[model samples]
Target: MKINFALSAFLGIALFASCEKKDDPAAANRTELISEKQWILTAVTVDPALPLNGTLVTNWYAQMDECDKDDIAIFRKNGVYEFNEGASKCDPNAPQTAQTTWSFNSTETVVTVGSSSFTLVELTKDKIIDTRVHTINGINYTFTETWGIKPS
Candidate 1:
């Protein structure tokens, strides 16, 4: 009889413990989503590929050197942004990491890192996309950059 009573109490307690509110990923805010993962630049595309030295430059990210390609970024909740030179460094003498302050605009639609700001197009757990329109050589171009969670 005592064994059955103890088992029932254990099961009841287990059930209660399982019922505790857990953080829902879908319900997480932008700050939470941004800081949750180490980001790696996946792609950088420019609309209306610019002609450069007889070749149209569309994917700027692909043009980056292997050393530059492996760099990563981490956004901290405390308004700190870290730019990490992953396993490789473009310049051996350069610091392995750089940090700067970051913040979102009043509406959270724009994210400012250092002196630059980008409009957030998409922000998800696995990926983030930001865009900006810049005038280069008197031509307005839309640049889109994408970042994905660093792969294991």
Candidate 2:
């Protein structure tokens, strides 16, 4: 009976160890998470420190139509980034595809796209948040954008 009890305890401990949770998805596969699906901008916050900044911030959403809201961004594993303007055109004369290049900084805290770079605020399986600050003519503007995978 003693041997049987000891064996059972050992088996239980082994089972528990094997059932440990896996590594975090974000930490293990950030690039895969960011590149696997097309991300659409869900929300944007803009803060500008200029006289006309208020109007720009207030009228930001109104400036984009329904189709503009559906614009999707694709991040390729090869470091190519493409922005597809949705079916409806914001400007009929403008090109639909905006191709660019992207790369993560050494620490992976910043994502650089072409000449601009954004601080990666948050990255998860279903959501991403990036923030950017720009200074123009002594005026500072900060923009924060949240993106999510496109619905099936």
List the candidate 1 regions with Cα displacement exceeding 4 Å.
1-26
lDDT of 2 by residue, 38-64 (tens): 777676555762234334443333343
TM-score of every model?
A: 0.79, 0.71
Name the weakest run of 10 consecutive residues (lDDT summed) in model 1: 9-18
User: How many steric overlaps are in each model, in order?
Assistant: 0, 0
lDDT of 2 at 118: 73
**Model 1 steric clash pairs:** none
Flag regions of model 2 displaced more than 4 Å: 1-26, 48-63
